[model samples]
Target: MANLCVAGGTGQVGRDVVRLALDAGHTVSVLSRHAPQAGSEKHHDGATYFAGDVTTGAGLEAAVAGADVVIDCLEGQFGKARKRFADGGVRLLEAADRAGVRKAVVLSIINCDRSTAAYYASKSAKERVYQESPLETVAVRATQFHSLPVAVFQAGAGVGLIPVFKGARFQPISPLDAAAAVLEAALEPGSSEDHRIRTVGGPEVLGMREMAVMWKSVTGARGRVVELPLPGAMGRYLRAGLNLAPGHAWGRETFVSWLEKRRETL
Candidate 1:
């Protein structure tokens, strides 16, 4: 089995990648800003954790040393996307190269290069960094996660109103499915000459209104689904379905099914 290191291992997608890597019997190491305390919710039994900061290159050499593959699942806050993704990706790739990593995999958003949104632009920049790296890099671009709408709806539910973009549609994939794709890419046999990009999306695409309604039905959330005009480049991007990949509908879980499963957990 390969020695795999996952950056941002405590995040949503990172958690699943770490779990799947361990289940496959690979030696797993997690590089994060803070190591999980023993018996904490973020701690995984089979994986080792390292305190590392990708942007500043702190603790990175130790974290990546002796690792065969590095899966970059790092994400940045709203105003810090460039620092965390573009600059941080460069640092991470440099460290991985120095440590003789064979392969690198990164999670990205579908159609990120076509959008002017700050976050999407930063993601596209990160992809470029990975593509140019000497390591065999695989970029997995996925559609929105199933949890996004829930977060939006939940925030609005507190005020009894859920806003649905007037003309937007979404094809949201489960983080579990996305993580599976990332792990598969990280473990795939390849050389430094090989660099690939792939896309994955949910099983179905639905209007924002339709998804909002379904969310309310499943959660019994008391809120009026208000249709609002989503302005700006991000809105236009969503309305044009630039965020979708119907041909790459690789995920098996439907939005409703995910909601049902999540409800059971809660």
Candidate 2:
């Protein structure tokens, strides 16, 4: 096990990284705006929560001080997601380098091939940081989360209408699955200097409409089903090459299967 420092340890995907790293017997430092609440501390004995913000560079030197690897998942919302994703990571990289850390991995979105999509663009920019960096870097891009469809359907529940992308396809994975990959990559040395990317996707791909109906039925969300054709030919290709890697790694939970397990809980 390695000494691992995780930024954004409180975010959705970051939570999984903290949990998995701790469970794997690695010493963990989870950086958050504040310490974990009392209840949140019980599951991971290996995890130490450090109060820090990627933007401020607070508490980061200590967090990365003795770390063998740093996993960055910090992100922002809207166009802000892009800015913070780029700058926040550069800050962490500086801290890690100063601390003499060896391995670094960052979570990025797919097809962030440049500033194409606001979110993807930001991710792409951050990827560039690692490219120019001397530190060992790996950018593990994951598919849209398996939880997303459920989220979309749930948010639309109050409106009593579900919007479906008729021809759009999604190859989503559980956040845990994605997190596992980032962890694995952090430990495994690779060939590329920055190792620009990799993808972790579900066992199968499904149409967006079918996914919505399955979610609606399972969650018992009564809403009008408004099917919208794929957002344009481009929508079909939104993350066209992302969320997939035929032989890389497959998410244990399929889209509908994860929904089945989450339905009662949501």
Which candidate number has the best TM-score? 1
Give one digit per residue, the lDDT tens place, for model 2 in 62-90.
88889988998777767555567688888
lDDT accuracy of residue 72 in candidate 1: 94
lDDT of each: 0.90, 0.76
Candidate 1 segments exceeding 4 Å error: 191-193, 264-266
Model 1 C-alpha lDDT versus the unseen true structure:
0.90
Q: Candidate 2: TM-score?
A: 0.89
The lowest-lDDT stretch of 10 consecutive residues in candidate 2 is 230-239
Per-residue accuracy of model 1 over 61-160 as CA lDDT, tens digit each: 9989999999999998576656577889999989999999988999999999999988888999999999898889999999999988778778787999
lDDT of 2 at 34: 77
